[model samples]
Target: MTDAMTLDSYLAAGGVLTNPTNVPPRYRAELMKLMATFVDSELAGAAGFADVINQGPGIKERIAAAKIVLEKTDHADRVLKIMGEFGADTDRYATHHPWTARLDRKADIGATRSEHDMRLAVFNYPISGWTDAVVMNLLMSRAVAEQLAEFSTVSYQPLAEAFRQIAPIEAHHGELALEGAVKLVENGASQDMQDAVDYWWPRVAVSFGRDDPNRFEHLRSLGLRHSTNAALRERWARSADEALKQLGLKSPS
Candidate 1:
């Protein structure tokens, strides 16, 4: 069998590629794109959240926000290091894009990425205020948890190991958001929290993007993706809805 066929067969049999040298050209391209998207999103997310750290309502909140910012930057660094093994210029890549740049709150970009970065479209919209920032964090962190769960099983062993280590930290970020939301609700910010939820629900929902069966099938065959976008989106929606309900809020109507 050809090298590509042998690689495909091995991946199909649940084999893992441990290093860049073992990655085929096509797999390398897709893997690089995946890693770029993740690193870009994390960097953009950290930059945006950093702006709101001072807006947090209390010292604890600020600390939590700061922790998130620091850890997310670390996560990006981890993935970018893996990309560097593929000859990516890690230094230039991190600074090449204006990670903090965002569109107007009213911009309707859907799931499309911005021209200069691969961040999810949800991050492109500005966080409105303290309440809005908390709400956005709660929602988006859940989405991140779902995506990380899927990626933790990727065919690239090193990347998968990085994700495995990062998953719990990301999940803890979600827990912090939940604590913040509960506190906000108890402080009579229910209406404000709900408004933020309504505003962010659809935007965060679209970050899962649309399902493309053909593309999904191809990625699945390569051990790059294990679930359809729609399935992951639904999982996120269910978890998000439950989180809102716990806060005595509802998903956008």
Candidate 2:
């Protein structure tokens, strides 16, 4: 009921910040880190998927894959513009890394970031083929949807609004992936698709991040995060599991 509140109190009370000028130093740093991770992940994911577009089983599948690649790059550009407001050299930042470069598919670098960028670790692994790529797309898209939903409630209004606009597009990508997956299953690739699911499930889950209460406490205090990583991961797992079940695929152990 208080008409006037401190920045901390305002944010804690679900208030929003509309611009970069007034953010606190630590909040700005944290926000930049968060945005960087998103931008880098989208860029890396798009780049990785670009090569696999040709591997899609049919014209429609190829089109879906291609569309996902385009939109993910666009999503990165959208968030990178916000990072630019924080004085980032967006031009250099986008091309600074070899976004197309990825580690071996069997690399065991769990939740670790590459030296060159802040993309989630799941993206560092290479995609094997059409089924593998589609499975990765389906699982990771759901993870992205969950993360974007959490981010849409971020205290930064501009970024929150951007995420809100983006959530459905990202959700649509998941729908496309789901549809492709169903077709793959129908085409007698169910076992191969299940194998791909098993490979990507754990990696995608790790993208939700560690269940660090201390870190979540700091982020939550700033209203940068509205939910715990564990909670978000659980939500994603439940949804992803049901989706997989409907497709006659088993959830990864």
TM per prediction: 0.98, 0.96
Model 2 worst lDDT window (10 residues):
1-10
The residue-by-residue lDDT of candidate 2 on 1-253, one tens digit each, is 4433476788888878888878878889999999999999999999999999998878988998899999999999999999999999998987899899889878888899999999999989999999898889899988998999999999999999889999999999999989988888889999999999989999999888788888888888789998898899999999899899989998967
C-alpha RMSD of each candidate structure in angstroms? 0.9, 2.3
Model 1: which ten-residue window has the lowest total lDDT?
Answer: 6-15
**Candidate 2 ranges with C-alpha deviation above 4 Å:** 1-5
Whole-model lDDT, candidate 2? 0.90
